[model samples]
Target: MKIRSDILRIYQSLHTWVGISAGLLLFIGFFAGALTMFKQPLDHWVSPPAPVPAMLREQEINSLAQQALAQHPAARKGFIMHLGEHENTVATMSWTAGKPGRELDFSGKQWMANLDQEGKLQAKEELPSILAQMIDMLHRTGGIPGKIGDEYLGGYLMGVAGILYFLALVSGLILLLPTLAKDFFALRPGKNRKRFWLDAHNIIGITSLPYHIVISITVIVFAFHDQFYDSLAEVVYKNQAMFGAPPPAAAKPYAAKDMLPLTSIISKVKAEAGDSRISEIQFFGLESPRPMARVALVNPRYLVQGPEAGYLIVHPYTGVIINASMLPGKESTWSAIVGPFFSLHFGSYGGDMMRWVYFAFGLSGAFLFYSGNLLWLEKRRKVQRPNQPLPVQTLSTRLMAAGTVGVCLGTVAGVCFTLVAGKLFAAAAENINFVYLFVYYSVFLSALAWSYLLGAARASVDLLWLCVLAALAIPCSSVIMALQSPSSNNLTGPGIELVAIAMALTFIYAARKTGKRIRDETKDSVWSLQQIQ
Candidate 1:
């Protein structure tokens, strides 16, 4: 297992630099991504009570839909019918008349409908919470904001980071190979802080290497899949359509009432999908000549096309299956090849237990990056001899320490603050989503500036305290809401609050440890108040 000294040194340099370059961004992405595992619960916790009744029978759902379609022309375009299965189900049926833009665009009017006590259709427009979407965006983009043309700017930056991450993984593994047998599971925790950190980092990285590799590869693909496809079209397909032409439109448009019953559609989908459970039925172009219904089914036993579920599209009028390529046990060859990647990245299989595992892995991944940066800083630290003057830490080391503290802790505090803000402003704010973005950036940027101004040691303690308060606010907000409207709370609300409470306690412990380190650690290093002075 011995390797050349020169090769080991080369890999060590490569692993260090590449990991430093990608570490902070990946930290944010992984931390936020972990939170996204329970996005439905967070969404439900922040959302207000449904404007329309949530409970509705099949016949009532039909009545509500038909009445809304007749009264509101926008409902004819497309709408999602909630089967009351998910925690975030706001209404029996809802539709959005948004600006003709990307599907993820939030600039739109949403309408929800359900049957009232008198069996009359009750419909209203409401603002949906964007807290979960914000977290998902962070996971996708690594907190790099803004857009480049039609795409996210963060996506392009993260694509480059993903490449570096892959390189770092390779070089790190190469470096670890020489001592793999002797020190694979060894963790020496003592006065040699550098050795301790390195041991912990290596252990986590090596154990989770497969998970990291999948994330690195999939991130690159997800970020730049459009460019990849465009290149394929020009080079491989000679500018031809990759999947061939889509089907032609029908001869005439159909009325909403002409569509098959909800029960009939669900039955057909179940018959086609076997034991997969239906969550929602999303109708697209219901008034158009070529209308389709996408039935979202969740079956943790198999890989899913999307993060939460797999889907099959069918003709809304005839109940004939349109596209079953994404359905489990019925995927096309290409889809079968690509589906597992999505399933693995999204943790879409193995039910809630798998989701919890992914959550733990995500947090561990974040810690891996954070500890990597700490190791980098420690490697560059200047230790003073007993008879010599105090050594000054390098500017690069100081800056890296500050940046790591700022970016990592800032993201944590920012997300916690945003959650608290969402609950506080849900009732009063006209656009709670805007409030979320504003609060997040304000706290995030402020934390970053504070880190640079006060240095990592001081800023770490301060921001950790801020994180504790922000996390504590979450459960307190829920408790207040429960007291004000006892009936408005749901099971998911308490679950989210309990997690927040645990997070608050963790931050409290972190703050105390950071304060202790600042006070007792060596003055020659960047992680001490004397260094800043």
Candidate 2:
């Protein structure tokens, strides 16, 4: 309690600089992360409107499985009994071919069955989630992996950022502790710019402090999970079971007489796993003596199969439950703890409502960093000479101004454009990812260049309007397609597009406000676009 003023001052400086350093990256992370909460839905929306094969009945599942195995021996190697099918879903009797990362190559393993004209079984792979995957990748990589030689390099940097953020949290809380009671609710938005920003930053940061802390810790875990596990094992377990699990049965192969039926395996899973929604039963290790099946279930109301939380492993041949995550009162203590962390980070614990809540919080979190950067620039405003050109200002602040406005707005446009592109290039599902990369990076880099060349104030204003156009283009494209063929447009995708446009319009409004600020308010600042000229 007897901390020195010098130490406190040092902490204050540390907090400011650390926050400013990671601000834009965190903004990108949070913004994209918010969208990722609804990644599945977005994946579905932008996915092909064409229907796949209908559901397989209980009797049909067994017959289909047998046929799949006979026709495609790779199905015996490892495949899934897909429990559900979507319009854009795919069905493969056998996973005969796949390259590294288990991305099925499908070059040799492709097969076709009786086409009932209505698709008795799924015909093709569901459209890949190009937009969602891109956003998710950017969030995880912090826009660094591609730039760096190694993909994990970006994650390593983000992990370091997490460390800095952890320090900022501690120092910030220390700074606010003495006045926590007084300014806990204090927000005076008078003429004082710092006061307004300080109030907002503190309010948002404090209220969501726990969430932020969770995010920081989880980001580190995600980026360096292997390291964390290795360190944890080395420090605590000493090669022992740090996290307990059901003992695996002998992996010896069994004959058909000894093996239990798939139905029996599923029944056991349902009984043990409770009211969980089964997703797919993944069969593996067919070449081995004892094949196994990962009975994957989607545990709604909790983070379940997405992170492999609640799963059951059955002997593939015998269908005997070798291991189950849902053993009654047998859940490992460490697993229980880790389960919620993944759930919280992925926002899969709750339903649609929770996703929306997370989305709002994520956008707010992005703003927290954006506002923090603005505050930094505002504080450094006095260090520059009056009416000095932006090029001559502190390189840090100038770069920050241009990079922030450019990258963030550019990402907005990139996403909107990619949505339209995903639809336009649905037929070329395999190559659509390349198009997404081209469009996204092109828009993103273009925005940064525009900002650096035209100046942040003007570029920011222009990009906001550009975002409006990009977003509106989605619905407009959908409408045009619908006019050409009414059945093609289902309105769900366009409805999302409309929402995006509505969101983009807010940027339009903000652009107007920013323009007013440059012309009417800012006089001696780099943001004073007219004055700078």
Candidate 3:
């Protein structure tokens, strides 16, 4: 409570510059990251319904798998058996083939198979939707595109931002320490505009400090994990493998018929994983010497290895669990030590309720960044006196204002428009994933250009309206699609639509408030319409 004046000044400058440097990038990441909380629902919401195949009896599943494997050689590489019905499940079984790529890549062709009325296999090849993957990519990359070798350029850039984010958090906390106790709960709303904004920003930042700290650390780790591993290999392990070599291959290849029954595999997984519900059972290298199965299960009480579910790998023929390190309550010491980072960063441990809490925290974090930039711009404003010439705002302040409005609002509008496009073009587009990227960048760049040309004061109102319209299009498109085909709509569609409606209303309010600021409060600042004139 009694820091030297010079010390406070040093931290204030550090907090300002560091936060400004990283704020916009983090805004995009946080906004997109929030949306990823409901990725499964988003996948289902964007997917068009296909005719469900006749349900297979318990005995028929193995028959279907055998036929699929016999006819399609690629099925031997890997395939997933769907154990439950969902909107995104095109068939009871599916496998992807073609050029190999990363898990997030949408390049491969998907083949779906299910039993027909006569218990014969019906298989078809189609392209998978990229909506959810695209959103996740934005979250990971912070809207920065391109790659350096196997890694994303945006990822490394975000990792740097994450470092600055951590510094900003520390410096910001230091600046607040002197008056934090007295002013922590103080949110004075009056004619002094700067005080109000600072108070609001401080409240949100301090309240979510723990969440922010976790995100900042995890982001750096995820972005440069490859580098971390490489350094460990070079310095710590030297000539040895980090996790040890893979298991040795079997003497001979195994056929699909040699694999245990689907029911038996599920039972084994449940027994091993304990009170968990299985969603998918994926088999890999079935025809290779080392055949394996990965079972994905969900249990709220346990920490998950994947984004949505905990996983266990097993030997397909023997039904013996080969690796339970990633399973809940069965994790190895190393996994147990490392699991909380993933769980906290992903909100993967506590089920849907935790997802919603993370979602709220994500939005609040995004707003914190947005307000940081706004506060920076306001702090540098050149005030005008009555009957005097208008104060000339600095180029840096003008640019910051435009960049903040353009980048933040543009991301919001771009995602909303892309969501609408995914539904509208689901049946018509030959390459829907390409359509998604094209639509998003087209809108995003256009908005950025609009903000620069119009200036932040005027552009803010227009972009907010754009966000409103774009968000409104989501629910409206769903309604139109539902009217066209009654059975096509699922529960997820309405859930997404309701959120979009709420978002649209929020933007509408923002547009009005921004217009009021420009008209009444910001006459002397970069946000004043008179500055553009």
Candidate 4:
């Protein structure tokens, strides 16, 4: 019995310490991941770059391909085209270098070009849909470039924290198992703040357990992507060779380059591929004034057809079908499946309805981590002895507490700041991304200082108000911009509006609770005075 008691105490201590260590990171990663689902809509909200639908004409593609071939020589080695979705159609062009084994990126020279109805390339000024791509980059790496290693390192830590997170969740549920029978979905207000927080934590945690579990598994898979790939390669491919052949180096270099009619190749590709919409056409080795060009048609059927559909490639000079491969080959299929995990984690696969579901789960996970720390603090309050009153929480806990509060509140503020900057800054908004990120880190640091100086309760109250302020500012700023110039079609303006509404509602809720607590304490003071009189 004594041994069992000791074991239980040790387990509890480990849980508390690990929970404190990982709680904040888990919160930030999960919340940002949740918002990542609405990447396109948010893109639309920030900047409605006129989107093109999935359909394209052969003649138009032919001209573009021929022009690209005439311009670039390296495009023949490897080519890729992505026909944007129906609601937002856009063409992306990429090709390989003339020589292989020289560059890591298989798609050689790349550029985003808008196509006219006749498939002619539009000028650079005509197509400016990079804002959505910009936000996506921010979501992936906190908008930092050349430092993805740091982001991945954070992801690795978050993965460890995820393991700890799953453990903490299970242990928490185990502790609550006995009480669940008495209080499922129970939230009794007017109780002590500790009791209220405990109830809120339990209800949200238990209710969202399934979502939490799935997200945990997905995040783990994403964090250790190599393991996931290795397992696939081992089990499915039987540890055999790669699925697709590497494109050849200088397969066909024309001694006297001649301009190929792009129109003929499109007809040939469409006839051979059958009902497949072309996403992009790359002119292989097209950078040189005279280069052989190959056009690749992205098959839409393969997109929905279970990774078995292959693209149709046509020789622009001869209008001959060059290379064709189905999608299910070992590498292509694996790439497609693995690619969706991040989108799934962020809720980007499904439309708006799905995004909201992911957002709810994401926020719930954040709350679970935050509450876990509070539960530890509460437990310590009860157990601390006069001789050892929880020696000023370990340095790690102090940093984490501040970091958590700072990151959570700071992120809300940064999003608003970025949106405002995007509108006012316009062409210069890319720089704003960096500024927003710095401000976010600063806010997180501030939270740490505030938490250490102010009691946790007071700090929580103060920060919640600040979050409300930032959140509200997002929409207000957007609306102000819209009102000033109705012609500005910045989607970010409206996106900020949505964020502002969410913030205002959250603020109202916090204010009510804080107000009531203040009133209750004042009433208690009056009762004590009356008794003294």
Candidate 5:
């Protein structure tokens, strides 16, 4: 019992340090991740509606393929038909600029032939909005770029952080075990501010323990997936042949114009795939001889593994099925295992409802981290005695307090500015990615600077108001667009505006409460506005 008590005390200290250490980065990951839940809708909100009157039907695709192939004979090298769902490349055929995903990050060198309003075939490349992509990049890489232009370095750091997070969770639960029955849901909001913050933190953490565990494990798994796959190949599945040979290049030359129609292939795949929504058609080995295409689909209901190709390989020349992995069909053990890993992490299985729920939980998690930092600061705060100058706040304590204000409210400002840029830029602006980088970091760094310069109490109230104003940009931009052209559908704009208003109101309330605490509190603590200067 004595050994156990000693271990418990050690773990208590460990939890405090570990939680503080990982809290800020995890806050960024969680906040960005929550926004990523509605990534598709938010991306759609930023994306322009499909222009050019006529849709890219199967008949017109021949012209598109011919035009693309003629312009770049390498279309046969590596090609794909982006049918609507793929971002920024709707009604387009993409040819390899580099080695596709391996050498290049995103779809490289895409060309789409669409009929103009005057009935002319116009070929152009499309670019994606920076707002949604920035959020996703922040979530995955923690905004940390990796070398090889391929690896995700932020994922590695976040993975390490996730492991520490799991440890902190375990240690926290252990420390709280003795008081479990008596103070399980306690929220003592009296004179002891530390008690109130600790109670709130504990309640939130304990209630969401399982969820936190799932997120941690999933993040870890995703971060090291490549290593796991390599291990599986070398050890458990060494003797087995998991996949078949790559489809051979065309055995005979074929004109791009003679490519088989798309509707029949889609119809056949559809009939076989149950209700899977056909998303992509990848054309392979046009450079070789035997050109083949794979039709990929999206499973809307009951399929947790949305990442599965759910595709069928067919000869585009003969319209004959080469290899069939049709929907509602059996999959290999590898895919069965790997599919759900990505699906659960990405929340791609469930539709909007699930995404929204995940979004709420994500925000709650960010709040949990912010609250944890405040609790730590409150616990260690130093007060003054007689007429002596106020005790200097420890550098670490001041830094943490500043970080909480700077990172949290600054992220709010950064995101709003990015969204405003996305909304206002009608034509694809030059250096928009650089613009995103500038806006976000400027706000974030400035907040940190101001936090230390002005001290915690003053900074908190001022930054929170800044947060409110920045958040207001979302709705204001939407309202301006609405007023300019009232006919636009504006589906995501209103919902996003409503949420922004609510968050602004939240900041207002927080600023007021923080102000009150600053004025009313007597202790010469970090939150107190009493004489320190």
Candidate 6:
């Protein structure tokens, strides 16, 4: 009995310390992940971009391919084309201009190109939804340059945090076992501070355990994507390039002499990918006229569930299907499981409803972290002398608080600002994103600093109000901008506008509750200071 008790105590202590260590990073990751969940919707809201139907007919491809090729003859050696989807309209192509890695300095080396909907020339400036793309890049790579160095580091941090988060969650549940026998829904706010905090944490965490588990596992897999991919290759491919996954094959720069009939190839793709709508196509080794072609087809409905979802492969010659496999049978069992893990993390395996569920759970995860900080602070206050100077907060705690609340509130504000800015600025303007990021951080930092200096009771009230105000602004800004803009169709502009309205309403309610709490507590002097000091 004594040995088991000691082991349990050790686990509890380890779990608490581990959670404290990784809490902040996990908060940021979860918050960022939640934003990523709505990236498509936010993209649409920001730029009011149109979604193109997945219709890659032979004639369309032929016209676009010819135009693209004529514009970049160098692409013949190695190139790829991504026909845009319902959410995006610009077709993108990339190719190497010379030998792999080593090219004549004076020669045009390697580059990428973008084409508009009608096989017309388009510049990178033409894509207005780049703001959302930029956010995605930041979320994925933490906006690293040269190589994905910081990204990998952040991934490691998130991975360690995820493991700790899982352990903490399990231990937390075990600790709450004593209370679980009572009313699980009890939220006895009138109880002592520790009891109240424990109750709140346990109730929220326990109720959301399934979601937490899923997010934790998926986050670790996502953060350590290299591991997942390596596992996939080891287990599924067994050293064979089974999926026609890209090979390192490249050709020396050569003049384009013979051109394949792109029209014929497009026809073949449509015929072969019957019923499954073609979302995009890529032409590889484009520096040579006879480049390898590949196409991707998505059934829309199936993709949101698992690997039974979509088909993507390289066709060595436009006419042949090189490698084909559904999500379930396409790779080894390991790869198959890993595929679903990716989808779940990105919320790509489900429809709009599932995405919203992910968003909610993500927000809840963030809330868990925020509550954790407060709980820790409250715990420390109990042992500290009243009216004495408080100990300095650790750098991690300060940063965690700043990042947690600042980023969350800033994201809400930033999205709103992007929508208004998108219409005011020209479609190609990259400054819209710059403005949004700057504005969001400015507001976030100001609010966080104010909270820290003012202390918890005052800061909580103030910052909570700030969140309410920012969230409320989303709808108001959307409405005002939509009314002023010429392109403000109800379906396009007002569709997202409605979401903003709902968010605002929720915030208003939160603001009222928080404000009332502040007013009521201030009536008592002790409750105003030392209860939370």
Query: Which of candidates 3 and 4 is the stronger one according to TM-score?
Result: 3
RMSD of 3: 2.8
Error of 5 at 161 (Å): 1.2
Candidate 5 C-alpha lDDT tens digits along 1-533: 12378888799889988899888889889999998886656766665555423446776766666666767666756577766454344455655555554212332344555555553457666444456767877876666666434567787888888888898899998888888878888899988878888999899899988779878888888777778778878987787644544455655777766766666666666676676666778987655577778877766454444443366677777777676533424445555565555566666656678777778889888988899889877766543233545565667777788788887777777777777766666445664556666677788788878987887888999999998888888788777766766776444446778888999999999989999988986655778776343
The TM-score of candidate 2 is 0.86
In the range 50-153, model 4's lDDT, one tens digit per residue, is: 55543555555555555654565444444444443533434444444435441122123344444676666652312233344444443434332352443445
lDDT of 3 by residue, 169-235 (tens): 9999999998999999799998887788899999999999999999999999998999899998999
Residue pairs in steric clash, candidate 2? 98-105, 252-289, 253-289, 253-290, 259-318, 260-318
For model 2, residues 379-436, the per-residue Cα lDDT tens digits are 7776566465542456666778888888788877877887788766656556666777
Q: Return whichever of 4 and 5 wins on lDDT.
A: 5
Better of 2 and 5 by TM-score: 2
Off by over 4 Å in 4: 1-15, 48-56, 72-82, 85-111, 115-120, 125-151, 227-239, 242-350, 386-401, 428-432, 446-458, 490-496, 511-533
Q: Give the alpha carbon lDDT tens digit for every residue of 444-493 in model 6.
A: 55765665565444555556566556655666655655676647542454
Q: What C-alpha lDDT do the candidate models reach, one value each?
A: 0.85, 0.70, 0.85, 0.54, 0.71, 0.57
Off by over 4 Å in 1: 50-55, 100-107, 235-245, 251-257, 382-391, 490-494
- The sequence of per-residue lDDT tens digits that candidate 1 reaches over residues 252-358 is 88888788877788788888999888888999888788898988888888887799888898888898887888898777787888889999899989988998899
Candidate 2 off by > 4 Å: 1-5, 84-96, 100-129, 146-151, 185-191, 241-260, 303-309, 326-330, 383-392, 428-430, 493-495, 521-523, 530-533
TM-score of 4: 0.70
Per-prediction RMSD in angstroms?
2.7, 4.0, 2.8, 7.4, 4.3, 6.0
Clashes of 6: 19
TM-score of each: 0.93, 0.86, 0.93, 0.70, 0.84, 0.75
Number of backbone collisions per candidate? 0, 6, 0, 26, 6, 19
Shift of residue 131 alpha carbon in model 3, Å: 0.3
